[model samples]
Target chain A: AQSVTQLDSQVPVFEEAPVELRCNYSSSVSVYLFWYVQYPNQGLQLLLKYLSGSTLVKGINGFEAEFNKSQTSFHLRKPSVHISDTAEYFCAVSDYGSGNTGKLIFGQGTTLQVKP
Target chain B: DTAVSQTPKYLVTQMGNDKSIKCEQNLGHDTMYWYKQDSKKFLKIMFSYNNKELIINETVPNRFSPKSPDKAHLNLHINSLELGDSAVYFCASSQRTGNEKLFFGSGTQLSVL
Candidate 1:
């Protein structure tokens, strides 16, 4: 079975400050990782994804994540955030063993509150 | 035009009533899925269909049924709803199976009272 765990339930940071949201996963087989963002009263949007290649992946809105295979972790980071960055972030994983069903196991979302 | 869309953005119904949420994707994706988001913001996949064929059915109750009339349309029907059934239901689609990026609908918020 595959599972994802978000270390924080909520994170509060002042605007223009740096932020990191930690995510850890456990899977017996190879996996693909992704980050999604959801704004208030809106659907989720893909932030970035890690399928293969370099461990460091950059995403939209100046967001990036590093995939540490040994650590089994993919943490999202932003050097500076704006008030509009306040939203819910989710970490998800899909394992290759599922036979390409496109089924994703998501972690409990982390609410990012960008204080002004 | 919206890439993915679900009807009845907000649905409020009494317990024991039956309801259905309709979903369609204009992107012409071959796979569609239904996901549930609980109050705690935990998302779980309920059902998935590939080209109108059922591909994945999670450990969800039988009362929840999904139908895909075509490759671009997937609808979810719930019977005898309970208080626990009150959650936001999302419909998503991808270009194909296999770890592809998904486009999600705005979601249908179902409230059982």
Candidate 2:
């Protein structure tokens, strides 16, 4: 079984400041990584995913993440954040070897608070 | 045009009552799923259906049942609603299985009074 760990539960940042959300996973097989965002009382929205190709993946809203195979990490980073960027972020993983039936395993989630 | 929608955005009922939440995805995806988010904001997968066939059923209680009448719709019915069942339920859809990312509904807030 695969599991994910999000080191921090909350991250507070000022507007235009850079931020990073750490995520790590433990799985026996090859896995696909993803980042999702959720506003207050809303469902999750996919921000970015890492399937193949380059380790550095760029997502919407100027957010990006790098897949580190050696460190087993997929950390999300943004050079500058806006007030609108404040939301809950989740890191998820699915085993590629499990075929199409693979269900995503999500992290505990981190709440990003971007203030002015 | 909302890609995914769910009925009764808020549901309030007494304990022992039965309630149902309906979900529909206009994206024409073949796979759908139900996930629960507790007060602590922990997300857990409850069920998944592919082409109206049950594909994944997590360790959810038997009181909770998921029905997929068609590819674009999936509904959840909960019996004997308990305070512990009070949480936000989200519906999602994907074009394929593992490789596909999910599009989610706003969610239905269920409160057991």
Best by lDDT: 1
Return the clash pairs for model 2, or none. Answer: none
lDDT of 1 by residue, A12-104 (tens): 999999999999999999999999998987788999999999999999999999999999999999999999999999999998773768899
Model 1 global lDDT (CA atoms, 0 to 1)? 0.95
The per-candidate count of clashes, in order, stands at 0, 0
Q: Write the per-residue lDDT of candidate 2 for residues A1-116, one digit (tens) a residue.
A: 89999999999999999999999999989899999999987889999999999999999999999999999999999999999999999999988784558598899999999999
Question: Backbone clash tally for model 2?
Answer: 0
> What is the docking quality class of candidate 2?
medium
Task: Supply fnat for every model shown.
Answer: 0.73, 0.69
lDDT (0-100) at residue A88 of candidate 2?
Answer: 99
Clash pairs for candidate 1: none
Q: After superposition, how far is residue A41 of candidate 1 from its true place, in Å?
A: 1.2
lDDT for each candidate structure: 0.95, 0.94
* For model 2 chain A, the run of ten residues with the poorest summed lDDT: A96-105
